[model samples]
Target: MSALLAASRASLRASKAPVMALRRSVHIENTVDNVLPFKAGKHNKGKVAVGVTAFFVTGLSLPLVAGLWQLYVPIAHARSK
Candidate 1:
């Protein structure tokens, strides 16, 4: 009887718990600092821009490449057959 009651309580808690969700992080401020000679202003603009662009492209490309690989595998297999 105790085992059955425990199982019921576990089910109730599982049902009540919230589902986990992924969240996108937001950057509100300049995270870079002391490491660089120039922390802010016009001098760092081009460098910062290129770094951000490279980071953004790498971030975007990874998922796209994975999805394309997933799509490509079936075509490759069928061609092999």
Candidate 2:
């Protein structure tokens, strides 16, 4: 019978080994060590420039604020009188 032949073919096919998929792993590298301490102290200059700018800003603004407060006191006293 055709059913019996199909059963025998299915049984024969099951005796072969199962297939497995294989893959190669991807490689990665760290880049931080190579980039630090940049050329000719230019990177350090950027940091120093920021610090200098902050120092100048703070130094100049304090006197300006004190002068403003000094000017405000006279006007406030006049208004109160």
Candidate 3:
């Protein structure tokens, strides 16, 4: 009966040590709900819109330019003959 009590105490201590270590190792932060609140900005919004428009326009125009060049090359070759 004494050995069983001692074993139970040892197991309890072993389980509690890990719980204490985990509690100490955890880091709690003061988090806020509005970390970055959205605000209207005409200048910045215009710049971002222009940048996105330019990006998509350049992306789409490159393929169109390439296709046009391909068509022009065949037409020019046929005209040269």
Candidate 4:
């Protein structure tokens, strides 16, 4: 999951540069429509941010629940020795 997020960040960064460059070259008259694609890029950023947070929180919580169970359950004990 971490690798996936890293790859996504890298991809976004790599693609953003050229789009920004394109923005600078376009005529000012239709600028709003010309830059419309970039607005979708911003939405992609939001989606990626949410995805990373969801994956991270779920990843951290699963092992924690197991660890707590091991600590509190008597019959599940291996640490008693």
Q: Go through the candidates in order and give each one's C-alpha lDDT.
A: 0.80, 0.73, 0.75, 0.73
Off by over 4 Å in 4: 1-40, 75-81
- Stronger candidate by lDDT (1 vs 2): 1
Ranking by TM-score: 1, 3, 2, 4
Provide the TM-score for each candidate, comma-separated.
0.49, 0.41, 0.46, 0.38
Highest-scoring model, lDDT: 1
> How many clashes (backbone N, Cα, C below 3 Å) per candidate?
0, 0, 0, 0
Candidate 1, residues 1-81, lDDT tens digits: the string is 999999999999888876553344643555554444455556777888888899999999999999999999999999999
Q: Which residue pairs show backbone clashes in model 2?
A: none
| Candidate with the larger TM-score of 2 and 3 | 3
For model 1, the local distance difference test gives 0.80
Ranking by lDDT: 1, 3, 2, 4
Task: Put down candidate 2 lDDT per residue, 2-47, tens digits, no spaces.
Answer: 9999998998877554553234474444364334333325447677
Residue pairs with backbone atoms closer than 3 Å in model 4 (clashes): none
For candidate 2, what's the RMSD? 18.0
Prediction 2 TM-score vs. true: 0.41
lDDT of 4 by residue, 1-81 (tens): 999999999999888786556665645444633444344354476876787799999999999999988778976565675
